[model samples]
Target: MGGVDVVYNPYDRAVNDDPYPVYARMRTEAPLYHNADLGFWALSRHADVSAALTDSALLSSDHGPLLDPGASGPHARTFLSFVAMDPPEHTRMRAAISRAFTPRRVAALEPMIRQIARDHIEPAVERGTFDFARDIAAKVPLDVISELMGVPPAERAGVRRRSDALLRYDPAGQMSDEGVKGILSLGDYYRSIVVERRAAPRDDLVSALVADGELTEDDLVAFLFLLIGAGAETTTHLLCGAWYWAWRNPVQRAAAFGGAIGAWVEESLRYDTPAAGVARRLTRDTEWYGTTVPKDARVWILIASANRDETVFPDPDVYDLGRDTGKAISFGAGRHYCLGGPLARLEGRVVLEELTACVAPDYDIDRSLIRRTVHGNVRGMVSLPTTVKPA
Candidate 1:
């Protein structure tokens, strides 16, 4: 395959839908491609991506890992949480909340999570035709995070809207002034909630953090903002990705629905990862694939590309649920590996399992009409429409 340019805009709708072909070209010709347009280095091979993710000394996630040259606002600095922090600080902050995000804790919420999924889907199951993204996928993460944070159920919709707005970035350029303001507004709102949680003391994560004094009011709010920002949209994409993947592969979908759906979900994650790329700043000059990346140069590790590397994954283009690739980097790796991974997986499995059980027998998904989100960082369907047989 001929090499393609790696300097494409991430927000471009065309790139979001079919970046694989381009990524394939990059892996073949420019495994360590540098994008002058974006002013960052891109690593497309599996080894390079895995190395960059684990090399905290050489590559740091701090100071805006996603190559946003415009995120240098006061609010951005204030809202920074352990996600951007490295080493001892990251360990400390992560340890504080580690117990709450364990597999056991996430599993314990299975009943409640399943209940939420059913509540969201039951209404749509009867409708026969509905927007799966808006009506179903979008609600699961928002509801889960809101409930965990003790945000009033009634207020979740507003919080979701605010979070969506805050995370929005222009693919064309840096975030707009208004976008920065919206993010700050979200921080302020969460700060106030944290203060309230401190006063009242509840069983929620926010309350626990405040009561333990491990986090101040500001820290608690920022942490919640981080959780909501990191945890919600990624899970949203995972569901949408699953829906799109299943719609395209009915036989596999049938096999998945048969019994081993968890494996299917993991496969979907590897095939179409929600977090397509992660950025890290080069803390020291490094040689990647024989190319010298200068110190302070930003590197974008294309997780989607690495996941599909033909060398690492046989028949990388094809979706195989049974392929035991031994822990894909879809949830990431090393110290910054996602803490909410178990929660996201459980949520995906429950929702997909329930949806497949309830609707797969009755509905024919319209793959052609499925609309994908126009964002590079997240690969997902914006609207998945399907026709259902009457009950």
Candidate 2:
């Protein structure tokens, strides 16, 4: 497993389907394997990834965190978000975002999140069968995030479609033309909303951003994209991925329904991570693994691998809802930890609660119809069909 077996080819569909084996081999056989083909270094071990995440001066996020071989950091349009930025610019924007997207604000979204999940799911239960990814899992996050942004109900569906398109890539692993178009469309839509919020502020995230008055127009738009791209898609994947794990393990599913839904979410974040990895660029020449990393080298911190490190979790691949996953770097570490993590967990809890307690307690996942998404980053199903047993 030394040579090609350890190469991290993100574009390969097979790797996306089941990257665990590849990551497992990489963790032991080649922890510091550098893919000259990809022209980037990788950090696979849990300790190294954890350390590099906080080592900002050595491993920088300024050049963005998602990429392919020979691709630029972040995307041309999404370069404004704090996730793609390094400090002190990252620090300043983070403070402004913290001021605007506060804990109190996200907590207020709980009731609304519950209501949104109920509104979308309760009706679908009557159908007996539907795609969970589309009908429920995807809608809950889209509407909740949109509602937080003060987007009207009439516009939520369009927003979801556009955002989904923006994050999708072609089967050949290239970013699609539609994705670029989607980005452009969102930019226009958010700019219009920003203008409206400026003249007459509302009690939504966008209005809050406008009120902050610190972020530039481009930065505001970038932040909005980050919210949807980072939050929506990954969250949708989490719900579906959690379902994939729990459905396969009815015991854990029952446990989650009983009282430990939060634990299930945490395990899902660890067992089947939503965002697979995050990238950081070297600020200057640095020494790692007893070797020198040249300045401007791209270091791919494989969070998925770190979370599954055998040294940390005895049976790394097993989906244990009761597993203690405090040390997992699913939401990242150090200065760039996920700000919306609390909200994400809250949403996950409510979603599982509604599905099991209210909507489909005896539902069966149509595993044959489940389809994993194709993309360079993030891991999730694009379609998950489910049906309730006949009463």
For each candidate, what is the lDDT?
A: 0.77, 0.81
List the RMSD of every prediction in angstroms. Answer: 2.4, 2.3
What local lDDT score does residue 319 receive in model 2, on the 0 to 100 scale? Answer: 89
Count the clashes in each prediction. Answer: 0, 0
Model 2 segments more than 4 A misplaced? 1-5, 69-71, 74-80, 170-178, 359-361, 389-391
List model 2 lDDT by residue over 284-337, tens digit each.
987765678899988888999999999999898998987889889998899999
lDDT of 1 by residue, 72-166 (tens): 22234355577777778678778887856777777888998999999998998899888888889988888988888888888888777777654
Candidate 1 lDDT score at position 357: 71
TM-score of each: 0.93, 0.93
Which candidate has the top score in lDDT? 2
lDDT of 1 at 380: 74
Q: What C-alpha lDDT does candidate 1 achieve relative to the native structure?
A: 0.77
Q: Following a full C-alpha superposition, what root-mean-square deviation does model 2 have from the true structure? A: 2.3
